[model samples]
Target: MALDNWFQNWHPTFFQQPLHHDPIHNSTGKRLKNPTNLLPIYFSLNLLGSEHKNLKGPSKVDAHFPTEWKSKELPFHNFKDDLPGEEYDYSLPLRLSSQPNEHYSSPHVDSSTFEKSIYTKKHHNTDETYEDHHKLKALEITGPFKTWYRWKTLDFAYPSLLERSKAIAKGDFVVENNLPLGIEVYKDRIFMSMPKWKPGVPVTLAQLPRVPKEESPPLMPYPNWDWHSEKSCDLITSVFRMKTDICGRLWVLDSGKISITTEEAKQHCPPKLLIFDLETDELLDKYIFDNSFVKEDSLYSNIIVDLRQGDCHDAYAYMADVWRFGIVVFRLADHHAWRITDHLFYPDPLAASYQLHHLKFEWMDGIFGMALSPEGDFHEDRILYFHPMSSFREFYVKTSYLRSDGDHDDGDAFKIMGESRGPQGHASSSVMNQDGILFYNLVSRDSIGCWDSRKPYKRENLGVVARSRQTLVFPNDIRLDQDKKQSMWIITNRLPYYLIEGLDISRINFRVMSAYTDEAIKGTICDPNVHNKSTYLEPPIDEDCY
Candidate 1:
């Protein structure tokens, strides 16, 4: 992947300016490929620093606990480039990199506007095409973004949430690229996909005519991230579905889930598939499915999108629970929920700790880790889940019942991740690339385990790629990073409970916190003690999956 060699295949757009060797890697002995071949991988790597223009936080490397990147508030920061110990500011070199101040306003809309302009030209070639001309002309009334967020007080983490909270707080439409902590890409944009809530509850903001109106004020207003009315605001503002493809056209997968509960009547919520044409703010068609084949009263849960289009036609999509059981599949283009093509898996009753709990639902605390790999057929769609066994639910790390390879229900397929330690938060994460699959050890402090799904699909060790004694509450969101270390970033949401005082901090307040990753995690600290038994995170365990 030499730079000069990569230049051979890169498009002219990538070489618009004079290309020179990056001084950082000039003398490195290790062979490196050119940047052009690594566009997708690097795009995910440069999330925190040089990649995104606006980086807010002190340059000094403070102790990791509650670092600037961990805050669950609004995103804002001062301009900084290079690692604190290093002295290079990449902000100046990268075109899309926003100055710290730029984050306060909306990000660039050139991508979106350019897309629209191209469509206009295609529709109206003649100068006298009045209707087409008028259409593009009128959209100028309302520019791309209705509102932009630039964080001030907190570190870089809050901005991602603020985008969700701000969209809910404000009633107008918005275009966003804000995402989980440490993600550097500023181009994963989706136009208006959230349910706009005023004070509390889910409500769609259908205000139409994307173009600006003469008399009406544009709905894009800077709204506070704090929710005034607190009835499940997070769920309402949560992203329903996500889609990504190679070259921005090849399909990957579209996956999302919803949660809903109301008195006697209940239902599973699903994130709507929002297809985005990033260049233009226009939303493509949604992946709506027909649910007639599932139980008449069935509701949807968590999902996984594996969009691979090749001659093999082996591309697939997966749907399962957030913390526990249930996995189904169909083709990428299939929209019928009830018609899970060939596979459906549930927690096996005969497994070690996952002895059957004869309840309406499966497990409660075990939903954090869920990922699949095509490396081996035995575990192709084999789903994985972890939960804190509740007083009423069953506990299991890798439930065997969830895997359906013929009629084999031997209950020997699962691997136990913990004994009594409770896992909680958005910490449940699983991912797969060509190499292996990875997840944070829910019970171990800052420990992440990888199972080589390549040729052998067994839950064996590639050894611990990263570990630290630091008691990070939960390495909640695990991201792959081939650039730094094994290339992983763990996002932990820190919630402070008043355990010492009369106040009950157990109340569910989604505090914001996270952990940026690196090659070495040996020196990090761990939580001082185990969780209280009464915490809501404890999952009920049976004899099946331990």
Candidate 2:
């Protein structure tokens, strides 16, 4: 009955919704606890931001709340817009009351914090009237409805460097939760694109345990997630959407399934690695690799450093378990359907089927990013599985990687796509065209990009062939025999994008890049803005590096 390494070593009990509750003064006045249910992640759920997503002004702190804040009172918007019933006192504060001292906390401080200056100093523009909303104001109750009020005024709206007494003061700032999102996938792993948050802060990793899928809607009813899940890794976290296998299977790794029972790797205690069966929705197997990661600097030592979406070349599911790895094959046998870059396979599968028949590989890798081509299509490559690594800035999309290779075995992936060019904080890959053109766009972004194969692989000056977001594929993977014909899909994230057997980029569009190859896009490493010296002004749409 002793605790496993996960429980004993990590010492973290609250996983997914760590800051979902609060201790505040209730009606009785005796310090009572409450349920604000508001998250301590971002200041608001970002519903507004995503809705108002368009290229706008310079680095003006457009509602980037540094203070952890939330409200039963729908943020920014009026009260009427609050979700039905405002549900329980929606204003429950979910952030920690006090910062824990270093001694009481894990010793590791994100080393990345020190080495990489979270935000560049150039981002600080002093022209706009930036308001640090953290400060609260007294309620004046202005409207005839008597519900309207403004933030209590302070002497320093902007930094005045005033040494005199001010009127209003800084109010207690709190955080709001980013919406819980689930995606649709026909491919193995799911993807969480680069989530660039309030400038400096990137991710505050919180583990989410599996809850029933039926409960997902109720638990995470709002916010439109653009990806899908690989059923295997479902229950682990609320924020991440997993992918599935070709034949309706999910691929996930669990730490709490079966007991290690064996005493060999005592230190690596509390055995790890558990995979489930989609057919029976049960634990099919468990893998106890001796190379379990240990805890170091507050993080799991086995940290599979994400090459960061910035470094991944591209992906594809290929012959023999070999998805081209750079200039060579990364090899895959009885492999999981790979969409690694739509050009490369990292030897990881979202879920594996014990089949060794016609290779079902629709997701092909190109030179620069994920492309949906096939070196060889397996009949079983039905595409399923997904994982979103928020903090790491990499999207781990899973797909089948297991099958009966005659009598061999295979497996690896922290795992898994995308398109777009704007500082949307997005990542990209390139595809070579039928005529040798190379193009880059959102990974799996169907109809948006193409390249002239004749000139594929040109890292820079890759022509702007097209600009729509994705190539529309009727139905999802597997069922992709249907025809929607590529059309102009808009470029937006809030739209509902994934579902079980959902549409995948691999099954849809490509202009240049093909499996095992890469296409380069046109770009300038000169850092264009770095040379421009202009005064702060309204952002010009044409100049919108969106």
Candidate 3:
């Protein structure tokens, strides 16, 4: 029979025959009732047609099917709207086999099917291959552990079980207030940062095993529980972000402020940078920022450690003062710190308004995102890429300029990289891998975007590596692991909802996700091997500009 006619007459029972194995079976050991379950078969047929245009028989296509079929549920239903008039009602009960078949292979199937499935089709207008590869299936490492922010053990404040019970009964441990903000992966542990935005936060810096023992594990105070003493000025107070250097150390940027979201917010101590030896769990260094380096409203939000040629002794830390619109440079060599400011560090009024997950709010945050290019001979000086949280444009300046004692504004030291990220391009924390690929969170869009520094910073050159409305909602931070694999770690906490409307503790409000950097950008435009030309057109100039 003709291939097109065979597809038109295709029935769901094709795979149910004695020869082919059916992958998705209902709990009752029957085929799924929903016809949408046959969508993958349709996609497979279309893919086969595109590859072999001269296909004239259905038997030829059947011969191409792999002997062992993988019991993986294809995510093709997500693109149901792409079909002309087929509107897939997700409300229908479509059951999948609880047990997946481990042995599965086909010449047509790619490695992506093992992680997340991406079906591609050629765009009619352009040579671009429209793919769902941008949608990454992020594995939740931990949390919405907000059911109870229980400590691994009771400390001096609540030395006895009775005291701990009394504290919990008195609303001291407000579970919802202990939202996780920062995440870092070390040897076998994933360090987390919980800023004391509201009351009842027990520990500001905590750690969890990389492999969870339970579905949700409780946060354990790093080093020990004593470091989180409420009255200790030498201990960590609040941390928004941290960086683990090539050396065996964790650079924590502690904000030293507590109850920030409440009216009773107070600066418990001067903002300080803490360096802890990861192996020994000992304090390596604690440098408190000078009053001159910090403003009254200065909010030190992010940190990145730059080492010259992998020398731990010759390292420097760059921190973003979001509220003050400046970069604080801490040189480990001299134990000295300086603040640098430029007009570009400030937030743009046009990008201040944000609408995320239907929550509308305005934040005039300044210079929140910071990324450093890989150290090499690519440029004279290592480039420091940064942008404001309330802005869509990315700006960069040389490390030589930021480290210098001279005035920050030297003609045009800071340059805008490329066109604006359009309107919904508001990004938060960002990180660069050794390959010079910059990955950042598109907070407004619920996606992670990538840009190869070698390519021009245009819209077409940028690619969304991972996008999920469910998991990536407000991806607050992105970090690349220092391991050989170079994995990308992200923490998504519905910050806007937590700040504006309270988070539903019953639902998974926060998530820690990870993906190998190399695998994440595999077939996307971000991949240097993918040679696609830019078709983006610049917006016409306004009449007033002329």
Candidate 4:
């Protein structure tokens, strides 16, 4: 059955509006028509009728919260309001291009001051109203554990008898110190990375194993899940982040740096980019970033693959060096790379430190998370949305300019998109769907938030998709599952507790969550039906679309 036909046949009330209104497009010019329209639904859903229990994992805490907290441990805080779930529908005008008056002029706000301002505004805005009327409610669906480490056993089994061992001696490992930060799910298996920052490596990159059946028992690295590499030095040195293209190619950015406490020089291996085939687990290509493209303080934490040309090879991959305050652009076809530096990549002084969920989290992260808009009129003309981890504002630049062989000192192409919807808090990652719905992690609120590009980027248009104290403490990464089911996946590591205090191996230390994208932002600004007209930059619709 056709996608639109399926949605209409399954849930007639899904489209609340008539189909006659002219199609509305987003700020980036992607058509946002819903099921009521003749256009294809960018994010069609399967309409899984009922919610299921959380997926199985190492500990129950991975699915639910612990019954009690230790004296030194902090408790979960509530951020939800008793506001009405349903609201009248309203619309806002689209601001496609940057305006002369739309400049980054707001002064930065520190954590304490930012908190006071947020509380004051909440009280002051009681009478204020939102122009957009669509109401949205975030419902929990299910979450998976990308990878978990337990102290009781070197080889994890359903039942165990060993006691906690701290020594790195034969088979006894300190699993808490081995953090698995990067995750990419492809096909039936999930590919993960455990950066060699502290010690022991069963396998830095391997598939997350499922609960073993009676015949099959869970293995340390899992069976036939390790990436094919002849030597330890040839494999990924340290990958804090990774990305998967539409063509089933996994891109891994090896920072080549070790934990400061473990290595005296802080350099364990040379930084490089590795590409692999997800199906065969075969290394396809590799490139050691030129010394000029990497700075002494560089920490390539995140990567964004641009496949505007319809093929992965002719495209460009943008890597954000968090500590270096710069971006490195690499052309896959030519195997050449260059650096781009700007002050915008630096941390915002006011947003450097944040008090979220009753805990203080601070970092000096520069350009970290980034996302690419759908392909523009030309093959290589998409917009690149990016931001530093220590700031609340967002920015973008044209990919055409980024891929050009220009001098690294040039900084004329970047533009400040706007500040985030609320009291400007830190975000770990951001992702945009084909329909132009941009979803991001709200670190301060322990929630997931999103904005529809059809309307102006503001607080009124932005809405929270999901929030959980135990499940979403620190969402380290988020990505669209891209499995035709319209799902978005997220992973949280309770980073503050791990970095500030210490991790509890007995309890759950990480969580992987997934939600139906359409239902996740259903009535908010991101609702495709809210605005479906094309922007000035969008190409003319084919004659048949009308």
Candidate 5:
């Protein structure tokens, strides 16, 4: 079969029947269908979910692993002795009078040389590290943990754009332009977002084939992603998150702010929403956001597309402004927009600091992730689930309250659906599939967890589908493909490590991971096959953009 044809019909069962087994290796080596399962051959499995028996939990995290590099665990003391029934101050202040240590050493290394590399050491005892515990769980799953793609330093396909990237790297020794975030899978292609955190690098949005035609190559912006030209035709200032519609259009949110550093603030272009034809590779429309409500400090990072109206034009696009703490709603048909604000969008001071791998950092992010219930799932009303990255609680409000005929400023309309989960830490981005299962990245635990809206969001209902301290370090985005055979595509960039500890540019720093979405939710609360009828069914579209 042709590659594209095979990809569209690919299923997980093809791998279940292994071609050969090696006794020495004692492994189900490879699949008979394809050595690399990159094709889109999806299967619609009508499975009655596995009976709800208690499933085994992952092994305890190794106690011997190094928890911190330089700091020792301080002796525990009772702070209540001094301030009973009052808040004790935990913020320690540094003395500025002492001279600071200016000496530093480079920690970068080439991933190729393993013997002398920091990534590993030849220890005869195999039970020392976390990888030993993670390996058994991975083999029970599928595929080589071998990466899908990697880059020493991010570059572009075109020469002019490549040169610009090189020039920007020279000016600022530290840059995030190379880190890819907010991935959306559409058929045979994957669209990537390259935000302009540091200037000079070009192309805020790019796309490549799901299975690249060429051998594994460094990431490059697609369609000649050059810097913005005066034509304003194919220009994108900065983009963080995007969504694809049933109409084959890619909706991108260009934040428009390009400060030299995270502290500096400036707007290089007008904040706008751009829609592109994925098939034709042409710009269909650009809605420049010049509303009075979008403040200069606002950072528009995420977008959720709503098509419950049954047409692309009447659909609404909801965007989250994390920095300023507000939600912006855009009406596709009328091209009008408005902002909604509430205390729920603010971060909880208690859950602000978090630890990822070896780095500890404090963030003030608010309302970062938002997922919508499938249309007609809740008696014909859709509820949008959202939460702050600096808080553990999850909240939801009806689409009716958000989409009222002329109601945009109704803060009283917002509602909380569930109790606080409590300091589970940050989630980068999240999405709900047609089955009503919402998947979100767990930064604290270094795993992906899901919750079924139909059941109470307790520990029993919320289960970890996949976990890896290595592969899932900082999963920046979680996207469920809308194909018949569902698949979840997640991207992890180890952002905290790169920013705080500094990564060796010579090693692979970004990865794209995927698994069978249906199989993933099998024993969890979201498994819909167990039901006589689907939890939610997509309403037919009577209108198309084309």
Candidate 6:
């Protein structure tokens, strides 16, 4: 059956609703006449539907309503009053019809029926609001894995008991110390970064099956176990975050430090960037940052790669120095790097104090979150949006200034965009999708926030897509894949609690969740189709001098 015909036959009430009156443009800036038509195609090909039989990976699931669903239940927070505008209808499911031309008798179906038909379920205690029923929930892929691993038994399943005993005695693996930070998705494997913050982190960078049979699978060292040997300084020391570019290569930002959160911390090696070919699982290139660009207190936390016009050789990487308050720019063509510093890179003393999950702590982290605007024919200059972890404000600068070797002494080059995110607007990692929508982690509210780049960055424009106190305690990193679906991958480690008290091994402490970028922002203000009139905030002419 045709995809559109299936939707019309199965659920005619879906299209009977009011269509968006405002003009809507897609990622390519082409106006869409009826966005609802595009919905059926995505549903049939990528999402949960009877026609999604050919879909692969963890995403593939039987669309038929089961007697008892075994999938994890996602608790969604209610935010109907928070978003002001007409909400789009993206809650209906695409089910198979008994016969052609069949349609529902009523256009007004109980909202609960729509909610129950989908994969996610809301918290029982919360009242079912319009936002709660329509907001697309994040699906947990693989998570809450036992941090403490019996390496020989888990990885090999044949190593002698003596070998496992020796590993434990040598302090080679500590379960509580190994926390998953960054996450990236390739073709069939999901790569994660297990930074050496305390101790017992055997492999800093590891991979797992994207669709695992077991709920919590063991982490396998990427490439092979030999690449993570501690005897060699050339191997990965500690990796907090990484990025996979469009050229089929993984860009790893190794912090080169061990026991970072403890007094025994030491610099194991100079911070470096490692590029590995994902197809062959081989190291392509490794570049050590110049000492002049690094500092004694420097900590390389996150990385983002930019490829111009599909040119692999003519690429650039932007690395965030969280502790030193600067951005390190690397050119792939010449393998040269330079550092740019500004007062905006520094942390906000007031925002530094944080309270999450009833745990209080203070961390003065500088320049952490970084995202790039989508490149297009009309876009003359690609903008880079960034913000410090300890600040509620967002800032931006053009790539032209960053790529140049000239001095950036003039403060006008860096401009703060939009108003403050308020007291609870603190965010961790951020990424911009191909549709010009920026998705970020709201660490304080235990939610994921989104803002369309075409709209002004304000509280009214920013919308919360997903929120679950149990699942999104502290979303450490978020990345958008290059697939047609543009899936957004997130890793929540309950970071503040782990750093202050400790994580309860008995409970699920970590999670890897994902949602389709298009579906995630479908009905909220983040959707460019939703129209709202508001005054744009003017950029501050002068910045406060430190």
Q: Give the poorly placed runs of model 6, Cα more than 4 Å off.
A: 1-162, 535-546
Q: Weakest 10 consecutive residues, lDDT, candidate 1?
A: 45-54
TM-scores of all candidate predictions against the true structure:
0.39, 0.25, 0.71, 0.65, 0.67, 0.72
lDDT (tens digit, per residue) of candidate 5 on 1-546: 122432232222101111121111221222123212121121100000000000111112111111222212232221111223322221111111111113322233222221212212233344332223323122112221223444545654544545556656665323444567778877667777766665444666766545433223434454344534323634777778888887778888888866423455476667789888776667888788866756746778888787754466777888887766678888888888887766566655556677765567776676788887665311445667788776666666667777765755543345443334445446667777665577787776666767655443433335556655545667787776655455677777777665556566766567666666566766344443222121122112222110
lDDT of 2 by residue, 376-470 (tens): 11111211111111110112122233221131122122121111122211122222221122223322222123322111111121223222222
When 1 and 4 are scored with TM-score, the better candidate is 4
Candidate number with greatest lDDT: 6
Model 4 lDDT-worst window of ten? 44-53
The Cα local distance difference test for each model comes to: 0.26, 0.19, 0.60, 0.51, 0.54, 0.61
Highest TM-score against the true fold, candidate: 6
10 residues in a row with least lDDT, candidate 3: 43-52
How much is 458 displaced in model 4, in angstroms?
Answer: 1.2
Ranking by lDDT: 6, 3, 5, 4, 1, 2
Please tell me which model should have the higher TM-score, number 3 or number 4. 3
Cα lDDT for residue 21, model 3? 23
TM-score of model number 1 = 0.39
Model 4 alpha-carbon miss at residue 128, Å: 43
List all candidate RMSDs to the true structure.
20.5, 27.5, 20.7, 20.3, 20.3, 17.8
Per-residue lDDT of 371 in model 5? 84
Q: What are the per-residue Cα lDDT tens digits for candidate 6 across 1-546? A: 122322232111001101121111111111112212111111000000000001122212221111222322332223453322323221211111112112212133222232212222234433443223433222332121111111111221113447546766888866677778888876556788887777877878877655432445456676666777557679888888888876789998888888877778777888999999887779999999898876866788888887766678998888988876688999989898899887667666557677775777666677888887666544545678888887777776778889887876654566655456767567888887766678888787776777866555555667777765566677778887655556777877887767778777777777776777777776566655554333123223332221
Candidate 1 backbone clash number: 73
CA deviation > 4 Å runs, candidate 5: 1-147, 160-177, 213-216, 220-223, 226-234, 260-264, 408-412, 525-546
